[model samples]
Target: MKSAMMEREGFAALVLRLRSEGISDINLLTAVEQTPRSRFVAHHLAEHAYSSRTIPIECGSFLEGADLAVRLLHRLRIGAGQRVLEIGTGSGFMTAVLGRIVERVISVERYKTLVEEAQTRLDQFSIRNVILRQGDGSNGLPGEGTFDRIIATAAFPAIPKTFTEQLVHNGILMCPVMVDDERCVMVRLTRTGSRFEREDLFEVPYLPLTPHIASYL
Candidate 1:
């Protein structure tokens, strides 16, 4: 009953909100609009799923923002057959979108239930090639292939050491950073030698890093 209603709500969201907001990427907007945000949310919050505003979800929350995932991906200048590593898998919304656009993705989440449920939702869309793992997102998935692009859904106080260690040279790291009160910004980092070049982009709000989960390593 609720699932059916939420599914319908997601379609409505695509038409009313996401499309009109300049989220004109054919594949991106289509993937988000088609993907049921409600299914990824808790049952209690299902009714609010379609709103353009953010909705709370398990562990933390997920919201429809400026399409930071989409915008950051564009900043990467990703090319086909590129491998991506996504931290903070969240509702797997970003993961599914990346799967459609990239050669492959390895997405990690701290919560087991979120990972399981997100996997189910993504599978419903026939999204293959997104490998989901349960682990600490702050620490990049060990032995996961070198990523051409890395994006984190969680806000970074400063760039995490693990994520930077895993990137291949010339790769891009895109995520939100806390600069100061009312000064939060999403930025892009490109590695050059041992240093990183940071480019500030737009404002974004995101879940903070988590220190604990059963899968923490």
Candidate 2:
């Protein structure tokens, strides 16, 4: 009814804003439009889901802004047939969106509670292509095999060798890394044989990627 229509309008506005901000991929924009962002956030903060601002989720983590997520995904050049590995599950908002764009997604989160909650949301959306794992994302699921595209939602001091090793040939890894004490910049590493081509995208305000599984939320 009226509420559903408002939600549609909000998503439409969000898509428009994203396009203006340099998100040219039509499939990426459609994925963002179709994913119900409110369902991935707390009920009280659902109204702000469409806003380009970070929202706090469980386990003391925050969901990156929708715009930033879209921009990163766009830069990754994710294809429909590629398998994607995501480092931080966070609120599962990006996970859900990734599920729509890629062929399959394996997402790892340090917090068990977040994984469970994210699973529930993914189930609600009928997103069957995403598998949620509760583990240290810094390790990047080494035993599961390499992926076509790997993305880390958090910042790292430097790209982890484990992550780079988990990328298949010609695969891309997008992540934010600390450039200095006060700054973090998004970087793209493309694996080619024994070398990884590095490209720094832009400055971002992402939290540092942590190690080890959380003992408690």
Best by TM-score: 2
How far is each candidate from the true structure, as Cα RMSD in Å? 3.7, 1.5
| Winning candidate number (lDDT) | 2
Per-residue alpha-carbon lDDT of candidate 1 for residues 1-217, written as tens digits (9 for 90 to 100): 8578657765665455545555556656565556666666667876666654576666555744424445555566665688999888778877877787789988888788778888998889898889998877777777766788998877878777887888888888887777874456777889876788889888777756775566522
lDDT of 2 by residue, 61-115 (tens): 8877777778888889898889999998988888888899889999999999999
What is residue 57's positional error in candidate 1, in angstroms?
A: 0.9
- Would you estimate the TM-scores of all the predictions? 0.77, 0.94
Q: Candidate 2: where is the Cα deviation over 4 Å?
A: none
Model 1 scores what on Cα lDDT?
0.72
